[model samples]
Target chain A: MNIFASLSRKPWIWSFVAAFVVWIATILFTGGTSAIGLSQAALTFAAFSILVGIGQMFVITLGPGNIDLCVPATMTLAGTIALKFMQVDNSLILPGLVVAVAIGAVVGMGNFALIKLLQIPPIIATLSMSFIVQSTAIWTNRGLRIKPPQALAKFTTETTIGIPHVALVALVLSVFAFILLQKTVYGRWIAAIGQSNRAARMAGIPVDGTRFVTYILCAVLAAFCGYLLASFSGGAALNMGSEYLLMSIAVVVIGGTAVAGGNSNVAGIWGASLFMFLVVSMLNTYGAGAGIRLIMTGLIIIAVIVAAGGRNPNQR
Target chain B: MKRALPSDSIRLLIPALSLTILLIAVFYLQPRAMSYVGLNLLFNLAVPIALATIAQMLIMTVNDLDLSMGTFVSFVACVAATFLQATPVIGVLILVAAIATYAALGVLIHVRTLPSIVVTLGMSFVWGGLAVLILPAPGGHAPEWARAVMISRPPLVPMAIIACVVIAMVAHFVIMRSSIGVILRGVGGNARSVERAGWSILGARAATYALAAFFAILAGISLVGLTTSADANIALRYTLLSIAGVILGGGEFTGGRVSPIGAVIGALTLTLAGSFLSFLRISPDWQIGAQGAILIVVLGLRLLLNRLENREKRS
Candidate 1:
């Protein structure tokens, strides 16, 4: 494909360019090796968002106006629960993972029930679920401190081929997501449903069931991200998952995933997540306060929304 | 394809029943809550939440969600607490500007067909960042006159309850009883039809959002008056709280089917539920979950009612 054709077809290209531009900007500001160091650290730290962003991208792919707001709370719940179970014995790490994932599934089920049975809107259904899940996290743990298992922590921290294990895990997940979305019948179903759910239903697709599975998949991924992040950070806190609430959605949007749904860009999510992380890091390095950083992030999100052509006549 | 009466009544009935049940439960659980002081304490925070819910309801009337409502309210409170204290003129100008910005956002949303969620989500950070920049910390006194008006007591009714009643009445009259209200609801129910009828959909949406901003600023001012100080995060929870309030009150996302009185009642129900849980000595951690549980169960029951009503109609 020619450059214009590819640019028009591949939405992720924008994120790739944005990430590159930000990287260059960082290098110009910080001088060479230091910028590299910042990039390495940001990439490693951004793995969690990458995982969450990809999951969000999948759900958004399911349809326009569909979203999952429970990811943040689910992640927090999973992180705290994982630490709680693992604190007793490092040998219980596998069990801990299972429990966290189970909890996430349960939350997803609750969201599905609300959205499907009650016919509640996705935002409200998941938001209400988040409140419930977050409350459970707070009630059960009461802000207790528990250490992550030593082995897992070491794996997350250690570098192989100069890349962190967590980052590698994220990369593997991205590849898997790419293949799943680009090469599978399920991906085609999602695309069709996203374009027109009524039409897809008329065509014999199991629209509701597919959406149910997508929600569950999204939640599970978030739970896994939480587990990795908690272990890397040594522990978890109440607000640990708060930032992800908006960041996940922002990354998916910035990564070139259509907000109205029907498209998936796992690679774009990866690049967008890194770009977001670097934006924050760059602001921090410049001694910018939290307020300024927040303002910049908000502005960037708005800019991306406009660039995405939210009012595309075809979709409307 | 007839719009049956039973289903519509059932929709209204559920919220009314839920509010009654909640009120009875709260009173049964805590008998002393019947007194004037008890009522005052129970409803001290309800005014701002109710106001915010009204704001949310207006936007929903236009089929848009204002994700930034909480931060925008907090931003107003920051202005009330700081700039209003330092110089009244500049503070007033800033607020007017913010409301105008909200109107501009409505135009942008309508023109670009951007999802309100994305635009408001992005604006949330902008509003929150502005609030943080204004106060930097949580310490700022509300202007004296505003505080006086907020704290003033009326005979026979608690000030909070009175404020809630007045707000509900005015909003109900404006949005439900007036011709403009009909036009606004028309836009939400069927924008194409409204546009075909030659009504300026853009103007209606912009006006609706401006009204939302107006109510949000009022909520912020009231909040500041009550709390006596403001911070960027003070009203952060109001976003979800207001959404819950509107939904509990019988508002739908796509329809202009919202009730002003129901919104106030819903806000009160939630407030009372929270107070009752605290009275029961449930941990703060559990209180949020309990509220969410209440919301789900109530909404679930409404769903069941709707299905049954529909089935009956079909039969």
Candidate 2:
């Protein structure tokens, strides 16, 4: 096989290509003086997006119409509650992490229950769940800034050998996700279900159980991000997770994950996340106004999808 | 025929029934709202939301979702406030151009086989960015004539009721009764079959998306008219609100099945829930959660009705 053809067949190649081009554009625009700083910032911010993107990828892989609109809210609720619980105490770091993940699990279960039991559409179910979660956050938060535990904050903010700790955490999680998708039967089960729900059921795969687990897993990951984000950023704010809502979905789609479901792109997420951050930074560096920046972002996403996104399965 | 009527009636009646319950609760809590003035004040704010819901329902009728509905509306509102108010011709032209862009989007989506969700999500950002450029700080005057129309009062019924009745009648006639509406829905219900029948899927999609944009524009104009100002983020909440309204009104996500009358009722029900909240004097923090509860209860009722119907069939 031709090298170019084989590389192109891998859906994720376009994202990496785009990221590299954008990275070059930014460095050149800045007179090539701050490549290291730009790369570091891109990696650090991209880490949060990658974490949420991983969770969204799994859920989206479960087929069309499977999405979690509550990711941002789950993050907000988890971060707020965990920070409050820890109350800046260094000794309670482990318990704080557990608390955040637990909150995520509960929210995940509620989101799935709405979809499975109430027969509500996942879009609407997760949306309504987000509402409740957001309200709960507001009720608990009350516009106060509670400091995260000192050790936890230090761990999240500190870098090792010029690599951000948060990025390292995200790297570990990505490896875990890669293994989960490639090496595990559960991964294959979700892909099968996504490709054909009825066929998967007939083949004796547990569709509902797999979907349930996937939803929980996505929420747990979101919650984990929230915990680390609050610690890194100094405290939890009610609106801390708002940007991630779109960022998570955008990176997942732009990274070449199949929107029609059953395809996963773990590596593409990093490429897409880094590309997204760099693109925004580049536009900002060019002194573009918010309006221009947003328009460019939207247009870039559409252009990328048209160029890189394969023919939608539904079309055939 | 008899079997069909029960299921169909159950689907449509539930929305109206919920709206009635909400109205009663609001009136009971604040009896002063039993009067004509109170009624106008109560429902006047829902007109824009009702229009937004109709727009969402129109998109749903074609089996596509418009995540940009709210932002698009906000953009239109900004255009109406700044362009329409300062230079009426420019404003009308801008609105027309925006609607044309919407039609083009439909064509592009069809030809490209792209996911409508991602496309609309991208469009949301574009619209938001444009709106900000037009009015960055959220201060623009709604046209005087539009404000007059919004606040106009006729003899017995309030302007809101009259506007709603007119809206319901027009939407129902265009989408539910007309030949074009039938084809639009047919495209959604079975695109392949519609294509086989010599109708252009692209045309049908373009028409539906354009009509949805038209309604969203109406929503934005009415919103600015009522508030007498325009802001970029003014209608941000309407995206979710419109989605919930469509669902509450018995519109399914993937089907061509949608009811214009039900959508209006659903919008009214949501607006009333806010009124009921104030009457109950709940903390402002839980107000958003109450809206979620209303969504759950409405959906839960449908589930219960389905179970009951199944039990009756078995028995």
Candidate 3:
């Protein structure tokens, strides 16, 4: 009874349960031959989603009116600009990383300024910011597929002790996020703010500063995902970050984070990300047509939410 | 009721101001657009977008949103192009079912307390998939009636402008002046009080969603009429476009605050902004960015107005 209650309280367990079920089902399709390969591949792709997903989760935790719609645009700009700066020079990889995060920080500040200074809704502010960033990316890309440095590409693709390098990098970041959320004062401040902005202010929390930093952290994570993704895929493409917008949100919601805000979990993000990748691959492996695949994906998302999300308070 | 509606006069002025500025810019860039024929060409596409904006406006009225609007419109367009053109009865049935599905979604969101964005995002995939199944490619022809209705040339003014006027008036009467509209907006302002008044929040939500679905269906048919064909992704951007239009028209995200006439003008202004940019010979790549810039500038103006209003209140 105690274990069951604890499990129920941990919203992320559901996503992990779903992910494991999907993984097993996929393995069954291959008659157990593709288990290791499937797991590795799932982990590899899930890493990218996890990277962006962590960022989105933090923003979503800030409450109902808060969300970051510029993840894809930020990713594109960082990847494109960073790769261009590197020019395939291995020595420039550190600079490239700094450039991506710095761009993310700048975008974050801009997004917050629009919301705070101009009083625009976060949705509109991020969306409009995304458009400008997308344009900059287009201008920078100029139809070029600038490749990453030779060593970085090898590092992204190759495994360290049988774990894909990218997945390890994602794991490290995940740990960092977990620490920030659980073991830090910043995490508590954000949760308090999300629960009730007025109450948080009364409690002497620095609401605006915390909110600002959260946006910056989220953007920085997105940029990191872009930089790593560009390196992993051998180059940057203008449309590269597009798929991630939905992926990040899906993992957070499906992973069982409260959509109403004030509560979030790091583990669920990983589980949901893995499940998303596996589900797609499974549907593809089953010879399902694109239409069927999309329909099933949609239905599954609804089912998970209805089953789990219905337990939360009703929010418009 | 007064609180439910924001500063109404100022709200109207902001959208009108932006529209006039964009219109002047477009005229300066391309003198031909000043004429009836040129104006028609520029605004024909805005008609469908205008309808979609109204649909989004209704959802906003109830403080819920529909992210699947684009895919839903795409699905309806596919049905109109293929099935409606081939057999009217089946097409009508499908559209009716789609509208009912939208109503059901509203009830589901309300009953389960599910976030509309997540549920609608899921529905977007389902609708997109169904659209693909209905029209595997972009080759299906639109129904002849739809084509004729869209191409019908009215006298003295362009068909686009006439459609906009009619749509704006109808939406205004239905959403702003009607009893149901009042009650729904009340739900957005304070659902608890509305409930205390013995109104069913569920019913209001369903009605609002159903009405939005009706407008979106019309948008889809009109879009197909213009293109004479349909694809699964035909109106994918309409989701974002509709949301942006609603915001541009002075619709707030959470409040029941929305203006039908303002929304119509907002959609037209967006279409005109695109035309203005293209006439400036801006690269296709930067055109989207320019739209974003325009949105920001207009919103910044809103800030200025807001500050003035605040100062006046204080004084």
Chain B TM-score, candidates in order: 0.94, 0.96, 0.96
For B1-315, candidate 2 gives per-residue lDDT tens digits of 144465546778889888888898898899999987999999998899999999999888888888888899899999989999999999999999999999998998888878787888889889999999999997999999999999898889999988888888899899889999999889779999999999999999999889999999999999999999999999988988998888988888776988888888889888989989989998999998888888888888878877887787787
Per-residue CA lDDT of model 3 for A109-212, tens digit only, reads: 98998888878888889988999999999998999899999999999998877789999999999999999998999999888888888999999999999989
In model 1, what are the clashing residue pairs, if there are any? A64-A260
Residue B10 of model 1 has an lDDT of: 60
Instruction: Give per-residue CA lDDT, model 3, range B1-315, as digits (tens).
Output: 134345676788888888998888888888888999998999999999999999999998988878888999999999999988999999999999988999999999889888888888889889988988888888799899999988999898999889988999999999889999999899888999999999999999999999999999999999999999999999998988888888888888887988998899889988888888899999998998998888899889877977877787777
TM-scores vs. true structure, each candidate: 0.95, 0.97, 0.97
Query: What local lDDT score does residue B215 receive in model 1, on the 0 to 100 scale?
Result: 95
Error of 3 at B106 (Å): 0.8
Model 3 CA deviation exceeding 4 Å by range: A312-316, B1-6
- lDDT value, residue B157 of candidate 3: 95
Identify the superior model by DockQ, candidate 1 or candidate 3. Answer: 3
TM-scores of chain A, one for each prediction: 0.94, 0.97, 0.97
